[model samples]
Target chain A: MSAPGQAPSAGYAAVFVHEDVPTAEVDRLEALHRPLADSVRDLVDATIRTTVEDEEVRAVRAEVDALVARLRARQLDGPAGVRYNAEGRTWSWGNAVVGERNAVAPPLEVVRDPDGLVHADTVLGAAYEGPPGMVHGGVGALLLDHVMGVAASAHQRVTLTGTLTMRYVRSTPLGPVRVEARIEREEGRKVFVVATLGDPDGVTVEADGVFIVPRWAV
Target chain B: MSAPGQAPSAGYAAVFVHEDVPTAEVDRLEALHRPLADSVRDLVDATIRTTVEDEEVRAVRAEVDALVARLRARQLDGPAGVRYNAEGRTWSWGNAVVGERNAVAPPLEVVRDPDGLVHADTVLGAAYEGPPGMVHGGVGALLLDHVMGVAASAHQRVTLTGTLTMRYVRSTPLGPVRVEARIEREEGRKVFVVATLGDPDGVTVEADGVFIVPRWAV
Candidate 1:
């Protein structure tokens, strides 16, 4: 499984490796990968909310690192910079916390159903704790930004997070949680998106963001 | 050296930290701390854009970490939470990126002059880079959020980042830069602040924000 990326897969650049599958074949495998991505997303939430001990953290880190090395054996150049195929499909797999093919990303794979509903389900675990048993505020923002950005981008054009506002109604406990995002408005290069993060206890975090397609972006 | 706090220090905290101090004595040190804070703010921008090498990073990290451990030893329990004394003094050093006592923070000490002009000078180094030589976009937001929040709170009451917006007018090169912010308007708990990040080549980034005082805050 020793594949080569346009960028070499060693030394300083190894940190950015992710599986680069051929575009034409992804459509055939999307059905299978989608479910696995969901499971990985669960692992992320679990890592963030876990009350596991130091010994467990060590165990998990080593296991994760080993997985990272195996994945490194086959990789692409740098991160999955926003790429578009001849068929107009795009994917980013080296995203910090939730890139497909990014082992470090908690198996999150956002799926936009025929109805335009954007939803993600994932588990919380040990690595993401902030206030003991709760998810970190910055981490929440990261996930929200990605999902909300996805809603804004809608696979149409490139966009950057121009602005984001979050209201933490209550402490979000670590466990199975669902996220939903939808477009609210669009003006010029900016698209406004709204999202909600919830556990069993109703909604814990509500977010509104303005994502901008940079002036230079096509 | 560890003499509680003077009136001026509390006043400076009121200025940059934006919280109240229990002792009126904080006012006595405000004059001294404010200027010191301003210079330190310059340090932050310099560190972010520094062309320094690995040895410098290790040296700086060691000194910074040692100082952090020392401050930890002296403090009651972390930075003073946002609070107000009868005289209306407040401090919050737990802030990411700019808190005085936070080791992880780059140098950021804001100065709120009597005219209410918000001026900051800082340095950026390798650690803060996102695009090789440019400061991380998120880090820019963090610093801007901080000084802008102080502008909203105005050392009078509690304020949190409610909404923040940024424009990357150009690629902000790593180096020394200056930031300036001022109140644009206000509505109840919502305060509007605007700022710019600049080098000798004019402003590279501009920002506008809406900072809010939580419903519970007076």
Candidate 2:
């Protein structure tokens, strides 16, 4: 099967999954909707880092909630767990942290290169703030956890985040940023991965994680 | 240092941080009046898994907001991080996953044995449901993560969850339950820990985690 996040978004350049009805097909939507998904992802990081005002927050929340309600009205039973296409491409759009169609999700899409290295770009808006004008440490970990989870999976083994360690080198300003993750090593059921979240100015948060295929799952 | 969870409230036996604040220490008399912090913790879990009515939600929100405003009147500059006393007691009352005084916290208290084994017991009620009367998987993870983080620390090293792997063995029912954790191995900056959450009936969820000391922190 094609890997998750490999397919493209359709008609909308910023929104990933359109309201098209569910189809019997698997990989079809990815080719049509990746670009839009990519844009929304940027919106997420930007929102977290934005110095927007209360009025803006109200406006954004209203818009977001409306969008959420709209999607909810037509959703398939629950969240979109990872889905694989006819060609083996995987898509998980209803995910709270990484779903493309999910506006509530900070539009994160991890891109895997030929060497298996993973890099992603997204925006953090004001909504994700913990310390005023800065991204919450937990939110940073949440984002890192997913990216690192991807690295551990290597599109091979089905792995879960086993442990994550993060060092806040500095408070992350809410705004545009880049995320990079790489595999460190492997031992039995565990995989070690290192990753970072940074702005154009420089790196702000760095993380290392151990992901595992549980003894039972293995 | 002495472990936390030795407070005076009997209702708090299910929680870890049981230190009682002389009601005199608190400026706002009412916030401390409703219930002991430990019982409040149970209230929170119950709230999450509750089947309360809409009117109850409205009433609770109003009361909660008033309490919040009152607490804010006599507040620290921000959310509580982690605190410890000269007596070697540590308390994190504002942690989203597990904070002792936090009414919003699941109100979990994990105890460690001399052999390094860790165990926790909590009552899940109306507020934590995911499916029909079942505890949400994510909540289960949050509780497990903290317990394992404590296990990995074992008082010597501070660790952040680097990865987490969970298997939903079955739907967790809302009620009294137990959690147990133990270290599996340690390598460099990472510690592997395993845990389980279950009701009186049977094991419901199992987890493995990788806790890490950031390269910089270690």
Candidate 3:
């Protein structure tokens, strides 16, 4: 078998495509898509809690379907791969964590500090619940993993999650939550990171992860 | 701190409410909601890949917003928590993994074997992508954690994920995937479970999880 960051296997280098789109265009696209994603997120929450009659539910479904058809009339044929322009602007609008156009992705706005710490603040609505009013453990992991990846990918280096271990200290209630991650250390191509997911009360989940820069990218 | 199976500070019992809805009515509700979720899932993919003119995209957004308002005309004040009925029927229409009406939840159909194995077959589409065509590593963990919880909760016992560790053997392509879990063992109220997420060719991720039945339930 190949070593940790060796050749002979698949890698994500291809997904990081270089497009010629200008930085201003990228920002404009993000501005346009972010609101659409917000609307979709609201739609998801409303769908979960709707108490309308069956007829009303069915009518809403029809209208949603019609809107989807309108959007599909002109669309890309596949997933939105990560793209960057010569001006150093990057976008991945289909990403499952912070994609501007992905409604299923939690609307996480991540900020990378000058010291390399990465953090985000987002509200987990009804659509993210696992237990009664708490955020699903898996969803918590998902958010942590993404934030940790962002931390590891600082300095424009591409990295993929190698291993992740999450400890659920307590339940995270559905509402405003904060996730923070920072690099603990690095060895060769692997970066070790630590993170936490917390509600207003305190920390709920602590996570440690290893991220590796693939050989091909290197 | 409370012992593993002793009096607890927080438990899921309150969420597993005993509502007196009939099983037939639950089935009817599921039938009505599942189709809407499927359509929403489709819309998510379309939104991610759409290349329509900016005007068309804004028009779709307006229509989608209208639909959301219609659904919000009458709604529950809070989340749709887990509810069970007199006939031993349970429903959690807002669950992040298996909620019938949850558009953000992946459309997973889970099954339990008589021998205590839990499995699910689902298709991961464009919206689930993290790295180009591959499933997000966190999404893999989310699926494995849910399936392992199902395995741990066999025999009508409720379990919450206490800790989860995931090893991404390889990147899973976005397509047909199968997840399977089985109880590895049990100690007191803690159930140890193992699970895998795989594409058609082979396993792409392996996971080990500890699920705890909260103290109050015991």
Q: Quick one: best DockQ, which candidate?
A: 3
Per prediction, the TM-score for chain B is: 0.62, 0.72, 0.91
Each model's lDDT comes to 0.51, 0.53, 0.81
Instruction: In model 1, state the lDDT of residue A129.
Output: 33
Candidate 3, B1-218: lDDT as tens digits: 01111112345455557777798988998888778777887888888999888988888888888888888899989998777777767777888877888888885778988888889999888888787677888788777877887788776666778889988788888889999999999999998999999999989988998988877655
lDDT of 2 at B182: 92
- Residue B187 CA error for candidate 1 (Å)? 4.1
lDDT of 3 by residue, A1-218 (tens): 01111112245445567778899999998888778888888888888898889998887788888888888888888898777777767777888888889988986888988988899999998888887787888889888988888888775667878889999998898999999999999999998999999999989999999988777656
CAPRI category for model 1: incorrect
Displacement of the residue A208 alpha carbon in candidate 3, Å = 0.5
- Per-residue lDDT of B80-141 in model 1, one digit per residue for the tens? 33334565454333233343422224546778889988878887654344333455444565
Question: Chain A only: TM-score of every candidate?
Answer: 0.66, 0.68, 0.92
Which model is ahead, 2 or 3, in terms of lDDT?
3
Grade the docking of candidate 2: incorrect
Model 1 off-target regions past 4 Å? Answer: A1-158, A162-192, A196-206, A210-218, B1-91, B160-162, B187-190, B212-218
Candidate 2 residue lDDT tens string, A1-218: 01124333332122223233344443444433333334333333332223333354344434434333432333344223344444545555544355544333465777889887888888765434433344545556556766776777785655555445556566566678788888988888878899987888988878777776645444
Q: For candidate 3, give the docking quality class from DockQ.
A: medium
TM-score-based ranking: 3, 1, 2
